[model samples]
Target chain A: MNDMARLQKQRLALYGWMLVAPALALMSLFAFYPAIATLWHSLFTRGTTRRPSVFAGIENYNDLFADPTFWIVVWNNLIYAGITIPVSIIFALAMALWANAHIPARSFVRSAYFTPTILPMIAAANLWLFFYTPDLGVIDQITGFFGASPTNWLGQPETALASVIMVTIWKEAGFFMIFYLAALQTIPPDLREAARIEGAGRWTYTRRVLLPLLMPTTIFVFVNAMINSVKLIDHLFILTKGGPNNASKLILYWIWEMAFAYFDSPHAAAMTILVLLTLGLVAVIQFRLVEKRTHYR
Target chain B: MNTALASRPAKRALPDFDKVLDALGAWVLAIVWISPLLFATWAALQPSGTALGLDFSNPLTFENFTYVWNAVPWAGYFANTVVLVTLILAGQLVLCTLAGFAFARFEFRGRDTIFILVLLQLFILPEVLIVENYAIVSKLGLFDTALGIGLPYMASAFGIFLLRQAFKSVPVELEEAARIEGCSWMGVLWKVYVPAAKPVYLAYALVSIATHWNNFLWPLIVTNSPDTRPLTVGLSLFGAPETGVDISVISAATIMTVAPLLIAFLIFQRQFIQAFLRAGIR
Candidate 1:
C-alpha cells in the first residue's frame, strides 16, 4: 500500500483505541477487575483489631465447607431453583399461549400478566408481606371463612422459603411470557392449518408440534430464569432476611451477610467464586444452545 | 399458532367448548398472577384487609397515602433515583456509543479479541460480583454516593452489544458521504451513526431507566443514609421489620414507589412491551 494509505490505516487504528478506551477502563474497574480481585482476595483472612492480614490459602473455603449455614444456603438455593425454574416456565408458556389465543379482552389479560414483571421485586415482596401477616393478614382472613387456622407464612421455617419461591415464580412467569409470545408469533400459520386438516386435537398439536417449535425460547427463558434465581434475592431482604433459622437464605444473600454484616470478606469471596463457577457452567450451556438455535435458523 | 388463527378472525370459525374453557382458565390464571399488584392498588386506595376480604363498599380514603408520605422522605428517594438513573443512562449512552462504533467499524489490533472479552461481561454480570465491587467502590472514595451506585453499570455490555449490532447495519455509504463533506471522525459519528440508531437508543434508555430505577441490593449496601437511597431501598427500609409493619402504611408506600413506573408503562404499554421484545430478541 502507499504511504498515505498506511498512515490513514494507522490513524483509524488509533481512533478505534481511543473510542473503546473509556468503556474498557470502566468495565475493568467494575466488572473485570473485581472478578479477578474476588479470587485474589479470597486467599487473605479478613483484617481485624488483633490481626492485620495474612494469607490463609483455602482456609476460607475450608471454613465454608464445614459451615452448616453454607450447606443450608446451598440446599435452599437448589430447592428454590428446582421449583421456580420449571413451574415458572410452565406458567410462562401457558400465559403466552393464552394471551396469543383468540380470547375476549386478551390485551387486558396480557396487560395483567405482564404488569408484575415491570414492578420491583421489593415492592412485590412488600405487597405479599401483608398477605403472610399472622392474624390481620389476607390469607388468614380468607381461610378463616372455612374455620381453618391461620398460618404464619414468612415467619415459619417450612413456609418461609415456599412463600419466597411463589413470589419469584410470579415475578418471572410474565417476563418469560413475553419471549414466548414473541416466539409463538413466529410459528408459521400453515402448520396450524396442516394440523387442523390432519384432525389433530388442540392439545395434541400443542404438545407435539408447538412445544418442539418453541424449544429455542424455552431454553433461552430457562437460562435467564436460572440466572435470576441467584440474582433475585431482593425480596428476601424485606420478606425474610433468610430468617427463621436461615431456612430461606440463598447463596448470594449469604455471601452478602458474610462480607458486609459479619465482615468476613474472605469467606464471602470464596462463596462468590463458587457462584461464579455455577453461573459459568450455565452460561456455557446457554452459549451452545444459542449457537445451535442459530444453526437451525 | 393460536395468535395467527386469532389474527385471521374469518378463519376462527368455530368457538368450541374446549376453547371456551381454555380461555376462561387463562383469564383466571391472569387474575391470580396480577392479583398482588391489583391488591396493592386497591389496598392503597382503601383500608388494607378490607380490600382483600372483598368488602368493596368501604369508603375509599387517601389517609394511608398521607400517612406514608409523612412517614418517609420519599421526595429525597425520588430525587436520588431520578438523578441516579439519568446519570447512568447518560454515561452508558456516551460510553457504549463510542465502544460500539469501534467494535462495528474501526479495525484495530486485538479488536476481535477485545470485543469477545467485552461480550463475556454478559455472563459475568456485575450483579454477581458484588463482594469485590463494593470493596472497589468504597476504595475509590465513591462509597455511599449516587455515583457509586450508578458507576458500576455505566458501561453496560448489553448496551455495547446492542449498539454494535445497530451501527453495523447502518449503510457504509452514509459514513463515506459524511467524510466527503469534510466531516471529522467524531463528526461523522455524531451526525450519521447516532441518528440511524435512534430506536436503539430509545429502547436501551427505557430498559436502563426501568432496571436502575427498581434496582436494590447494591444501593441497599452502598448508601447508608436516605440521602442516596433510591426508591426501592427507601421503600424496603420504610417497610422493614424494625418499623412496625402496618399493612396499610406499607401498601401505600409500595404504591407510591411503583406508581411513576406503573404510570409510564400504562401510557407507553405498547412501546415498553416492544422495547422488551427488542431487548430479548437481541
Candidate 2:
C-alpha cells in the first residue's frame, strides 16, 4: 500500500508539471527570456554591417544620460504621471460617490462615465484630435464665441504636454471610477448611518469613514495609473506623435523610436532596463502595501 | 439594527438641498465625460465640410462612412482584430486554467517560487519589453505576423492569478466527491472546478476580450503590413495627417473601428463594469 501510494503521488506530481508546462514554456519564451535578454542586450553596443556588436558595459547608459532628449522624455513622463495619477484618482472618487448616491438616471450616469474606458485609446485620441485642431476644433469653436485666439493645442511646446495630460486624465478617470465604485459597494451601508447618528455630515462621513476604507482600492488604482503613465502612450501616437519638438515624448515612445526608428537597440534596451527597475520598485511597494492591507483585514 | 431600520424612512422623507445639487453635479460631469464620443458620433454623421460645425440641423449622411470604408481595408483590419482577440482569449483560457489548477491543488516542489516568477510578469508587461520581444519575435521568424502579436500575450500572468484565486475558492469536498466517483483529475477539473468557476471565467473573458481588442502598441510594432494589422494600427495609419483624409472621414473610421466593442459595452454595460470590478478587486 505504501509503495502504491508513493507511485500515485509521483504520477500526480508529473501531472501537475505537465499541466503547468505549456504556460511555463510560453512565459519563458516571451517574459523571462526577453527580460534577461533586455538586461544582457543593454550592456552591449549596437551592431552594424561594417562592425560587429560587442560588450560595452554601461556605455549605453552613459550615452542616454548625456542625451538631452532622454532627459526631456523622462521629465515629461514624470509630469505625466504626477498630474494624471492624483487627478484621475480624485475624479474617480468623486464620480463613484455621485454614481453610488441616490441620483437620477443612475445607470445612465455610470455608463456615460465608463464609455470612455471601453473606447480604445487610439480611438479616443482620434476623436480628441478633431477637438484640438488649430482654428476649427471644438475647443477653438467654443472659445471663439468668447473671442479667445485660436491656440494650437498639439503644436506648441508649452501647451502640448498639458494637452496630452488632459487626454490621459479624460481617458483614465472613468476606468478608475469603476474600481472606486466597486469598493464603495463593498462598504457596509451601516457605517454611513452610524456616522450620521454621530452628527457626521456628508463631507465628514466621506472624509472620516469612507476614504479610509477605500485605501486599498486607492493604492491599486494608483499603481495601475502609474503603470499606465508608461504604457498608455498610444494616444501620443495619434495626438502628437511626441512631436512639436518632442515636448510630449514619453519614455516608452522614445524607446520605440530609438530601437525601431533610429535602429539603436542598445540604447532602447538601456532605457527599457531603467523602466524595468522603476516598475520593480513599484511592484515591491505594492506587495508591501498589499501585505499590510491583508493584515488589517 | 433598530436605528438603521428607523432611519431609512427619515432619510427618504428629507428633501435635502445637497442631494439636488449632487445630482446636478453628477449629470454635468457625466455629460462632460461622454461628450467626446458624442461629438465624434456627431462629426462622423455630418458631411465633409460640416463636420466641425455646431449646426445641429446640418443634414447627416452616410457618405463619410462609405468613403472611409472604400478608402481603407477596414474589412481586413476588422477580421484581423477579431481573430487576434479570439486567439488570445482561447490560448489564455486554456493555459491559465490548467496552470491555475496546478497551483491551486497540486503539491509540487518549487511551486511557490514558480508562482512568484509568473506573478512577476504582471509588472514586466509586454509593452515594456517591446524592444527585446521584437527581437525575439524576429528570431523566431514570426515578424509581421498576427501570431507574433498574439503569442507574447497568450501566457497572461493576470489570467493565471485570477483563475488560481477562483479555483482555490472551490470547495474541496466537490473535488473529493468527483474523485470518489472515479473521475480522473482532468475529468474532475472539467466536470467540477470549471463549472463552479463559470462566473470567474465569464469575468476574465470579458476583461481579456476588451483588453486585446483595444491593444495597440505591440501590434503596431509587430505588424508591418495591412495583412496582419489590427484595427488600431490600421486606424492610425489611415488617420495620419499625411494621409490628409477629411476630419469627417477620420471620425467615421474611428467610430467604425470602436463601434463593435462600444456597442457591446452599451448593451452589456453591467457585465462590462462588473467584469472590470471583479478583475480590479484582486
Candidate 3:
C-alpha cells in the first residue's frame, strides 16, 4: 500500500485501542484480575495477625471437599437449579401463550405476570415471608378455613427449601415470559394458519410448530436461569437464612458466608473458583447453542 | 343456508369450550402470581389487627406506612440508590459505547480476540468474585462508597455487546457520507453512529437501572453505613427478624422499597416489557 494508506491504517488502529482502553482497564481491575486473584488466593492458607500467609496448594479445595456443609450446599443448589429452571420455563411458556392470545384482560394478565420481575428479590422475599408466617399468615388462614393446622413453612427443614423454591419460581417465571413473548411475536401468523389448513389442531400446532420454533429462545432462557440459580440467593437472607439445619443453603450464599461472615477467605476463594469453572462450562455450551441457532435461522 | 348454519354452530361450540378453558386457566394463574404483591399492598394499607385477616369490613389505614416511614432512614437509602444507579448507567453508556464503536468499525490487531475476552465477562460476573473484589475495593480505599459498588459494573459486557450489534447494523455508507463532509472519526461516530443506536441505548439503560436498583448482595457487603446502603440492603436490614418490627410494618417498608420501580413499571408497562424483550432477544 501507499504511504498515506499505511499511515491512515495506523491511525485507525490507534483510535481503536484508545476507545477500548478504558473498558479493558476496568474489566482487568474487577473481572479478569479478580478472577485470577481468586484462584491464586485459594492456594494459600488463611493468615492471621501472627502468621504470615503461606502456600498450601490444594489444601483449601481439600478442606471444602471434606466439609459436610459444602456438600449439603452443593446438593441444595442442584435441587434448586433442577426444579426452578424447568418449572419456571414451562410456566413462562404457558404465560406467554396466554398473554399473546385473544384472552380477556390480556394486558392485565401480562402485567400481573411480569410485575414480580421488576420488584427486588428482597421485597419479594418480604412479601412471601408474610404469607409463610405461622398462624397469622395468608397460607395458614386459608388452610385454617379448611380445618388444617398452621404450618411453619420457613421454619422446618422439610419445608424451608420448598418455600424458597416457591418464591424463586414466582419471581422468575414472569421474567422469562417476556423472552417467550418476544419470540412468539416474531413468528409469522401464517404458520398457524398453514397448520390449521393442514388439519393440525391447536395442540398439534403448538407442539409441532410453535415449540420447535421457540427452541433458540428456550435455550437462551435456560442458560440464563442456570446462571441465576447460582447468583440469586438474596431471598435466603430474609426467608430462611439457609437455616433449619442448612436445608436451603445455596452455593453462592455459602461462599458469601464463608468469606464475609466467618472471615475465611481461602475457603471462599476455592468455592469461587469452582463456581467460575462451572460458569465457564456454561459459557461454552451457550456459545455452541447460539451458533447452532444462527445456523437454523 | 340451513346446512351452513348447522356447521357454524358445531364449529363454534368446540373452540368456544377450549377458549373458555384457556382463558380460565390464564386468569387463575395470573391471580396466583399477582396475589403476593396485592396481599402486601393490602397489609401495608390495613391496620395491624386486620392486616392478614379475611375480613372485608375493616377499614384501610395509612398508619403502618406512617410508622415505618418515621422509623427508617428511607430518604437516605433512596438517595444512595438513585446516586448508585445513575452513576453506573452513565459510566456504562460512555465506556460501552466507546468499546462497542471500536469493535464494530475498527480493524486492529487482536480485535477478534479482544472481543472474545470481553464476552467472557458475561460469565465471570462480579458477583462471583465478591471476595477478591471486596479486598480490591478496600485496597483502593473505596470501601463503603457507592463508587465501589458501581465501578465493577460500569464496563458491562452486555451493554457493549448490544451496542456493538446495533452499531454494526448502521450502514457503512452513512459513515462514509459524514467523512466526505470533513468529519473526523469521532465526529462521524457522534454525528452518525450514536444517533443510530438510540433505541439500543434506551433498552440498555432500562435494564441496567432495574438490575442495579434491585441489587442487594454486593451493596450489602460493601456498604456498612446507612449513607451508602441502597434500598434493597436497607430494606433487608429493616425487615430482619431481629429488628422486632411488626409484620404489617415490615410489609409497609417492603411496599415502600419497591414502590418506585413498581409504579414506573405499571406506568410504562409496554416500554418496560418491550425493553426486556429487546435486550433479551440478543
lDDT of 2 by residue, A208-261 (tens): 989999998999999999999989899988889898898999999999999889
Off by over 4 Å in 2: B1-15
Q: Write the per-residue lDDT of candidate 3 for residues A116-231, one digit (tens) a residue.
A: 99999999999998789899898998898899999999999999999999999999999999999888988987787678668888889999999999999999999999999998
Residue A217 local lDDT, model 3: 90
Which candidate ranks first by DockQ, i.e. highest? 1
Candidate 3 Cα misplacement greater than 4 A, ranges: A295-297, B1-12
Per-residue lDDT for A67 in model 3? 93
lDDT of 1 by residue, A168-254 (tens): 999989989999999898888788778877887678899999999999999989999999989999999999999889989998899
Q: What share of the true interface contacts does candidate 3 keep?
A: 0.88
Q: What TM-score does each of the candidates earn? A: 0.96, 0.97, 0.97
Clashing pairs in 3: none
Which sequence of candidate numbers ranks them by DockQ, best first?
1, 2, 3
Query: Is 1 or 3 the stronger prediction by DockQ?
Result: 1
In candidate 3, clashing pairs total 0
Highest lDDT model number: 3
Clashes of each: 0, 0, 0
